[model samples]
Target chain A: MVAVYRISAIAVMVEVAIQSMSVVFGIAGQGKWIQEGGVLDKAVIEAREFVFPEVIGYLIHGLNGTILIPLTALILLVSSFFTKVPGAVKWASLVLLAVAVQITLGMSASGLPVLGALHGLNALLLLGAAFYAARLVRRSRTADQGDRLASRA
Target chain B: MGMGYAEHGGHGGQVAGGRSVTSLVADPRRPADVSVTLAAGKERFRLPSGRAFDGFTLNGGSPGPVIRATLGQLVEVRLVNGSVPDGITLHWHGVDVPNAADGVAGVTQDAVRIGEEHVYRFIADQAGTFWYHSHQMSHEQVRGGLLGALVVTPPEQPAETVDVVALVHLYDGVRTVNGNEGDVRVTVPPGKRARVRIVNTDNGPMSAWVGGASYRLVAVDGTDLNRPDPVRDTGVLVTAGGRADVEVTMPEDGSPVRVHLGGTTAVVLGSKSYDAPVVRPPATTLDLLSYGMRASLGFDPNRPDRRFDYDIGRRPGFLRGRPGLWWTVNGSIFPDVPMFVVNEGDVVRMRISNHSGDVHPMHLHGHHAVVLSRNGIPAAGSPWWVDSLNVADGESYEIAFVADNPGIWMDHCHNLPHAAEGLVAHLMYEGVTTPFMIGGTEGNEPE
Candidate 1:
């Protein structure tokens, strides 16, 4: 159970990293397309037109942010209840909360572009939370092994 | 443009030995019966409902001046681009105008840039509810308010019915009726009937229902239905870029009757100001597939001269060098999409299947098609003619149309964003070609 929880949390961290890279890659490609005299307007963006080769980054980022990350976070939260590691459930809850907020921010960023900054910020926060949650399980296992060794000594 | 369609075989192997789109126009010898000038501009305008929006406008308003003309009249519209930088072209939505007058930027004609003027001359051939919007950068311009209602009455119109144009639009996410955020009241005497023309100028389908009284869907997409029955407690789903005309009679008690648009906005018709009861939206919507009386389709769809598969699917790929999940037509992305080629007057049938996990309001310019079947079930309702048909995810539709209008017509998803996302294709008439090019110095991105 602890392994499942740890793996799920770590998976979220990896997914968040991919999401960040994908979005950055998408924007960078869009910027270059515009620089090369390709028109990038609201219509193009709304139509999700692949005017450039790097537009796949947006598709990847969108799928990871909306589906993969949320699924991984939910699994971590579910497994946290059975992990038996102290504070594992609390850390998992924080990671899930950040993900929920992250999705909301990402959805609203189009209408209110100012929210995009917070969306980026929350992604980093989610990554940190997932990393800490995964580390907690490893530290608990190590402490348990040390306790047994001390008792034997 | 640097990105060319050289790989797509340059006009789908049917480009040469064709007539130019410029020659397929209304009779230039006849003087225009109705003439109007529309100035396109981009400005921050405030609606009467106290809502402010920064968007595109036609002749100083979003839902621009209603261009009304009698049937059989030659309509001439001179479009002048005042200040919009991206350019603009007026598309006569739902009106089967001549191929040259069908204002599709880069398809029918080039986008009129700033300070430039383009004149469209076409006879108001079919008399019904229609509209006009910008085809240049339509995904943004149309949503930003570059559209208006175009109503064409019959040569001898009925004098008894009160006509109300409810040009429904969502400006910056705020739903409005005729540019107002609330109910637009039309003064109809008690017991007098009124026809509410609901123009859904949005991305998705909108549900329209009557609140206080039963209403009959008289016309859809500018084509009159064959004996449509009165609908009570049921909503009519109007596809994006589609129009629905609902006829309602005011209650003799003098209370206003509300025609709800997409559940948020409405058009209230009453003798005086009186609160109309807000009826709860019915759980079930009207099944248009088998709603009204059936009639002859003029042409048999079973024996079509040409059949095309407009299968809409989505996959991760590179389009114009942009990498992302993009909408596809026949499994090929934009510039690589199919150019449906057919001869003029040929009976064309198209099977539009959607498995893209999203709904797409497919709109075909220049011609209106009748729905033959949905998911293999033949249409049992009225002729059910439509210029735009909404195909939900996992739904398959078979539609047929007579290829009478000869030009390069755009058959694309009306969800402008989807069109931009590579969900666009052209219905090219055999031996018809356009000189206009997309993505050039003119910046003609006609979504």
Candidate 2:
């Protein structure tokens, strides 16, 4: 259970980082191709291909935060009761709270671009917190038992 | 000066020099109204201010000599390429030359090589302001001074006291008026009328105004304005690859009227001299949409047979291994952007919207269009005809035109750099095709 939680937490961090970079390209040029051309629409479409990929990026980021991160936090919470990992429960709660805040910011950014701008900035914060929490475990004898239980399940 | 219809049949196109040069031999018996010879080569010339720069010239001068003719006159031009390293072809901007004479580097003909010559024979059926420039790597060649003014006059000569062609270009960071880095003197007697034909050849629009007098806008992009009103303290913004003809009456006191071309270059008429005025745009611009007298259009622009919406935006993408912010049109990019398909005689309307936070001057080859509306407001003045239209960020323009010319024509941004950076597309007439491409082994980079 503990090993599965760490893997999901690492996946969440990687997704958040990719989302941050994709969002920047999605808004960089903003408007530069509306110039004169009879067949310009196709050229403009190709120029902005990075923008289309943004939706898929956001979906993955959403799934990582809403589904995977929560499942990781739940497993960590139940495992801490049996294990002697000090501050493990506190770290899991903070990770869950950070993921919730990150998702809210991501959802808010579509209607309010100013908030969208904030979403990118906040993603780095979420990634850093998740990275720290993912490695928070001491990897002692108790975590080994949790891992064995996780592998059996 | 009007030309009588002479049968131009069997003009031989001779192939020489193995896939590089295709020369057109004009029939000696075909009685052309005007014969002109141009030499395209490298030259080092000093501006009026004595600032020197190496540039590509059509006839050893920064702006190739003016080729003047009358409407309906057959103009024959022979282009001799004298070693420019790369190749070149003369594109008659604003003149609807026949497909063979259109001068696209690859589409119509190959680029003229070193020491090789090409002949361009076309009839100047329309009269107003137009220009000729090298279409082969035009973005660089034109800026390097490979362009010149081409004036086709009315059948009858005008009685104006003076006529001046002010082609605005930037050479080596210096603003130039007809190849002069500073004031160009145009002598016109007091009380006599003078006409100034201004061509904006830069990658952006230029503002021209009579700094100390009133002037009437006569024409734009080779189309005459109907009952143009004279206004002082105002200016006209000539888009990239666009032209504007303004007429000014000389002051009776012999005080020269300074026509400022974008703050740096100016035309000083008569004796009195004025410093180039700071080109501060007026709080309100000259609304070309409602400036001149409204005229009846032959067809209803409101009822277009085909309508296309082209919206420009930007995003990050990898173009040819270079990752950067690239432009988009209608949610797509180059090669995928709409290749507007049309047929001969189709009345097509395109609504262009720009949200890219920058200005783009749109240019269409083979035909000119009339502005129908801007931002949903119908044009209420003279039929605003344009081959190049300036579209600013956050603005939407509705333009319509009849597809009278049938061929595969390039339609792209007049801002050559933008066009090179994927803001380019083509207008394909049904049943017409091209054997040329952008990056072919036969050495063709049309932009």
Candidate 3:
């Protein structure tokens, strides 16, 4: 149980760090796009002139918002059942909802600057919640006397 | 002047000096009936010869001419077509005249046939800087040298030592000045204050700057004079068909000044200096919204008599149903549409609607109006003063101002090429009569 807890905590930290880095990189990329006359401006003059569409597609299909995030959450949730960790399923569900809301907001206000900021903010919050859940799971597992002793041995 | 026929690749050859070598100057004070012969014939035109077509202009020179007229004057022009194979018409852009006098082909009237002459007559009631060019097939006609400035001055203007009109013509990569790839240099004298009117007649948008002087913006689109807002930026971006009148108090003693435009710069110095000094604008507070608000300054809001909402956009037929193409107002082109009428001295509220996919910078010639609301919200915080407002896709703005200045005024987009693509109209003030007749001559046969 202690080993399971240690692994969960490390996974959460890595996920949070990656999410934060994504936000920073996304903002920098957005600024560059604006200087290049924004997405719409570029699309009008030269449809296939820019490479931003490829990046957007990658983020949508391959990044945390799609494959990695759900896969990670599923693994963590399965581990929760095996370890009998309380609140793990609830936290996972909340993180999933947060991601849904962020995507919805982004789609609704795709062209607006405010929406972009909000989407970034929500991603950070979701990352923080995931990390908190992992910490809780790790702490709960370590609370058991047998698990702590096994780790020490 | 004999027509020079050169076997060039294109339809016609370039003329030198843009204007005909044969000088024909008309007196503004005297009523003149001028016959203009516009033929599509091959002429031997030289580009800025030394620079290998550095000044690639039609008819041959850089800026064509300054067409001067007085307020309340009647003028007639006979347009004669001489081009090869294609018929043409001259659209008097921004001149508030009758529909028949508008000079648009296929909409208001048929194209002037080759060897045919069309007579146009209109009273100059509005005082401002306007222009005229070919309306039949604009892209080539305007790119050629068929354009000239039309300045109608008020009967009585404040006396000044120097009243200079600088028509800034910008050409893209195809043309240059003084054999330089990207430089057109202009000079202004030192130590003398001058009222300079800058007009942008380029197909594309360009920014203008005076290297060594700080100038105060006095008027926009020939109207709305308020406290000066001076910019220290490299240059002021003059969208196509936009005009800015500035008052510059030259530097002390004998400082030289240069007016730089479109990467090319020109030096105009004091009477003494052979090479003028480049004047730069000093840091100053920019008050872009201080004009046209007597109510904000403790006066009552002078409400206009009537308010109208104009849905400005393109028709489905214009771009062949190609969505998000071409700009228009109320689903019609300029010459084909009727003018929006308002009573004299009536405060008018014009709600401009933009349904086009692209953003349009709308400009009102001969008047400056305060932007009351944008997107249905009061524009109180943002700078509420502008003659040109950028109306984006699916947005609307309501602007209010008095229609005190009687005359036909042009209400159109500031983007020149877009205007060429059919985004122009007129704002007419009722009960205004002129001593002379205005518009195209009826029953006049083509030569």
Candidate 4:
């Protein structure tokens, strides 16, 4: 369960960093410099520039909501292992690796939309794997059925 | 015949072709002395011939006639203005004549008045598809049917079976094939080889195709004597001022074939009934002269003596304040004030700077150039060979080729209307035998 949490946190951080970097690079290419323009103006211009290529790249690479959500779920599942909640570790690790591969493919696609879409799909698979791992971890802990009842009381 | 004078709007008129008054006659074989008067106005004239052609004409017909001339032959054309509210002059498209015979209203020659006449005498030097129309306010005159094809056949062409000329005309943004609207149907007998020459005298985009068959693109914009390239699938795209010559062997007997055009899906065929087997020969490798290759037995690309950068730019609202003002080369309209001049054997490398806000297909009248680079970067090996190149806005392309054929060649945007507006210029070679007899009017001596 803890491992799942850690992986999910890492994925979120990576996504945010990539998105921010894309925004910055796009603005520079379009000739919108912060020193030359006001903050609001520059931000708006930069945001507009970042939209098309990035969205197209992400969609084509398949790195969308499906990949991210599944990855988060897997993180939650794996973290539950240490807490004696369920089969978290195994599923979380598998989901984490899948999501990681998806993200890597998306980054490496180099303007190809197909890889971006694949990246997005893998996130969903990661979430499913994480959920399954969590369920398994919880079941394993149930071996102490009597203790569970006492603790519940 | 005595010279009879008529006064109209403070202009003098003299009887020349046996007709005292300018009139639009129906006969194509009228006496050389019979002067026909044509007036350019907002009103329309119905054509006496051509099916479904009750078109608006400045003269008597839309796209009048084919002016025939042999290579190295000199012909005299007398232009008279009878009905125009303003003075006008005609420019012979792609003919390498003297500067004075260029017929530019304000630049080359003065506009012929309502009752006056201007005579142009020029020897047809370069052979290929050329056209003629009123250069003054060409947008309106060309639209009104003052344009026609001028075919100059080379004297050295080997004997061929059938000689056919297809003068393609366009009106109001539509191509009128064989006097009919839309794609034209051309019939070729089975097993027979034929030469197809196309001249685009329209103001819009155009492309040519043969349904279920492929053809070889031979010459472009009248630059012949070069090796040919065979094209498969979706025939050549000919912009407004461009021309293409293709030779194809007819299909087997009893097989139906048709010609297709871009933007429309139906096959265009003639109304004649045919019977025969449709047979196309097996594809074989054609020995074509590559852009950089020089061979004595095949077409050789011309070597350049100089090279320059030509930037195509467009300011918004250039056309009558229209927001979508399109394209320009070197910051000037076609036939700009200072034209490009070159001597024979000079290989010129022209870097095209495209900032026109739209894709412009640029074509040179007398030579095929090599595309050397794109956007300041060298092109990959074996770039697609073409005489006409479609350049996108904000992009830059470089083409280098030799200047072998002499005469004044026009380098302009292939868009017809744009060429009319000023997207044209000349390539001149020194010491060639020119067919133009300039200043040959009434008492002027030929230079």
Candidate 5:
């Protein structure tokens, strides 16, 4: 089945580069604790130390948009319906509708920072449609589908 | 041991820092009274209002000369450095000098480099008013000009009536006093008595005032205020690296007295043709808490065995990899802040609290503290002491101090970019140990 549709298009291009490096390292770790508690007064009284790598980069960018891009788009829609190829069901349904609009633009980017810069330009359009749907599963293999059935003999 | 250091010992004795914290409260000297030498160059100054910049000097004066001495003498100095760029030391800010001359560059030495030469020697032993800068990257060699003026006297050098120093700097962005920037005359004859001293060295908090005349706040930071009193309509301020003095008198109808220090610079004193008043710093200043009268803090700050607090604030973290909006200290940041410790005679008692909106100053290098109350009230004047305080924002003070100068000192922020944006913190003492290291590969970075 075209090698199981190239292993679900390499897990949807590694979950679009790990959810775009977890929102740019969670905007540089919550912009450095909102600029170190952005001062309110009563000067430095420290002791709040728990910052584990910006809390595991927003918990792996919220589990790569709610659990690794919906389990790699349901394993690329059941390996593009058992690989019947030919536009594998519209490129696996446009990579599961761009990972469901990139998880609703990362939950509407915390109330629209221009939708968080359009969720970082929609992760370069979900890594260029997941590297062109993993190169169309190597052009639908099976020797390019017997050279497209001998060019429609 | 020759990266070149001299050290000696006695001001409380530990003088080498294997495990030491200073404490000299005076009465030690054994020969050596007043031998100055300073150097440190790389100038292009000129500022008493005339305008010119590119600084970093000492013997060439951007404020690098005036050492003086007498009170308990012993002094020395030496320092050479020659072409400042990433090497220079000095730091006597409030003059406790000991934990190995406390110059503090990569801790207490290592940075006399550039052309090298160090000495120091201390012992002016608590007199009145002090100053000295360049604790390495002191926010860029003290705002690019290095610093100076450290007086002491009182061992009878009183021919009285005219002493002046004003030091107040802020170059590259203008605003000067000793390095000029505007009207700098100071002749003083009319009714005599001038004094002045001033020295804020920028980074914030300045205000000076005298105008037509009536002064007498007489010393602070270098101590000696006790019976001071006589004001006019108020102005004083001076926090940032702090220092005051004042005195005034002048106008016996010669009428010029200016003084100022903030805007249009000023010093004028005895008639440079009066008419310089327009500095504008009045949102309420001269509070010195109560202004002066209390007394005897000989000890017993309600009994502080040690108590810290600190507080400050402002978040968004990662001081070591460069993120923004830092300045925490107690809530942590900067190499993880909080060290405080203490023991040398331990009296401690901190309680700072700023809330972070702004105004910090703070600066507790060797030790002078004393404030004892602010938002919670208390300080009925006179024991204010301070070694660079201010703490504005939401405010909260309560100082105290008596660990009697030991070793790992620093307690940060004289606005050196808010201690380079982390706000800093330290106090160590219990078995000091600094071989010196802040940014390693050895470039110090002492803020």
Candidate 6:
């Protein structure tokens, strides 16, 4: 269970980074397309016209942020309940909270646009929280190994 | 082999032994009867209630001006592009105009670019509730308020029936009826019938119901229903890009009746200022398939000269090089989608099946089709004629129309977003070809 919790937390951390990079690449590609006189109107976006290859970055970002990262974070939360690591549940809860806030900001970014900055910042917060949860498992495992060795000696 | 625009042979250059799309016309030599020039521009305007919006407008206003014409009039509209950066074209929704006047950018004609003008001359053949909106970058342009109501009255006017147009649009996420955030009041004397033409220009189906009285759905997509029974406690679901004309007789008590539009805004009909009760939208929706008495469809759908399967599904794939869960037509993406070919006068039958987990209002430009069956169940009501038909998830609709109009026409999703998402196909006459190219120097992105 500790290993499952550790792996799920680490996956969330990795996925958050991927989501950030993919969305930024997507926006950069879109900006370049407009610079080349490719009108990036709602029609073009909805039609999902591939003005640039990096537009796939948006799909990757969206799918990972909405479905993959949140799903992995949820698994970490459930695994935290099964693990006996100290403060594992607290760190898992913080990661889940940051993910929830990040998704809310992302969904409203198109409408408000200003929320996009907060969305990016929340991704970093989520990454840090997930990393802390993953480290908790490692520290607990190391402590168990130390006790086992000491008692055997 | 790539499934991209490179595979499409419909753009630019004329096809051998085919009629040019520009050659299809409605009596070019005939003198104009009703001439109206609309200048399209990008404007920052505000509604009467002080709600501001920045978008493309016709004649400097969103929802433009109401264009009213008598039936059979030669409606000549000169569309001038003022300042819209991406250009614009007015597609007369639900008006089965001549193929040349269909106003589909890249299909029938090129986008009316800045400092350029295009003339659309068509006989107002069918009289009902219709509208015109920019077909270029339509998902953005239309949503940005580049549309208006077009009402065509029959030559012989009906007695004392007041006509009202309720064009529902969402601006910056604010739902408004005829560009008004709240109720738009119309004066209809007591016991007089008022025809409220509700146009759903949004991307989803909208439910409209009368609060103060039972109303009759007199028309659907500008086609009159045969013996439409009065409906109460039921709302009519107007598909995106479709219209419904509901006739309500004001009560003798002089109380205003609220025609609820999409449960948000409304058009109040009364003799004077009186706020009617805000009735909640009915739980039941009037099913057009069985709403009115049966009538002749004018043409037989049983014997089809051409049959096509428009199977709408979704799959993870690259559309125009962008990878996403894109909508497909007959298991193929845009530019690779089927080009339904038919000879003029061919009776065409189409089975539109949607498994895309979303509702798509399928619109066929320049033609009106009669719904024959849905999910294998035959339509038991009046011949439901529609230019825009809503096909929901898991639902299959069988529709048939005569290939009387000869030109290249767009058969695409009217939910402009879905249409942009690659749910677009083309219906072409055997010997007709378009000269316009999408996404080239013309920048014609007609969604």
DockQ class, candidate 2:
incorrect
**Candidate 1 CAPRI level:** incorrect
Q: Return the lDDT, model 4, position B171.
A: 43
Question: What fraction of the reference structure's interface contacts does model 5 contain?
Answer: 0.00
Q: Per-residue alpha-carbon lDDT of model 4 for B370-426, expressed as tens digits?
A: 666777775443333445566656778777766655544446665545654445545
Candidate 3 lDDT tens digits, B284-388: 323333332333512123455656666676544443334333555566544455466665566677888887655566766445577777676665432344566
Distance from true location, Cα of A45 in model 2, Å: 26
What DockQ, on C-alphas, does every prediction get? Answer: 0.05, 0.04, 0.02, 0.01, 0.01, 0.06
Least well predicted 10-residue stretch by lDDT in candidate 2 chain B: B1-10
| Comparison by DockQ, 3 against 4, better one | 3
Cα miss at B160, model 3 (Å)? 5.4
lDDT of 4 at B20: 12
Question: Among all windows of ten consecutive residues in candidate 5 chain B, which has the lowest summed lDDT?
Answer: B1-10
Error (Å) of candidate 6 at residue A50 is: 26
TM-score of chain B of each: 0.96, 0.90, 0.64, 0.66, 0.35, 0.96
What lDDT score goes with residue B36 in model 3?
Answer: 38
Indicate whether candidate 2 or candidate 3 has the larger DockQ: 2
- Candidate 6: interface RMSD in Å? 11.7
Per-model C-alpha RMSD: 10.4, 11.5, 15.3, 19.0, 22.2, 10.1
Name the candidate, 1 or 4, with the larger DockQ value: 1
- Please identify model 6 stretches exceeding 4 Å from their true place: A1-64, A67-153, B1-16
Give the TM-scores of the predictions, in the order they appear.
0.78, 0.71, 0.53, 0.53, 0.29, 0.79
Best by TM-score: 6
Return the number of clashes found in candidate 5: 51
Quote the RMSD, in angstroms, for model 3. Answer: 15.3
**Cα lDDT computed for each candidate against the true fold:** 0.85, 0.73, 0.53, 0.51, 0.72, 0.85
Model 1: lDDT of residue B72: 92
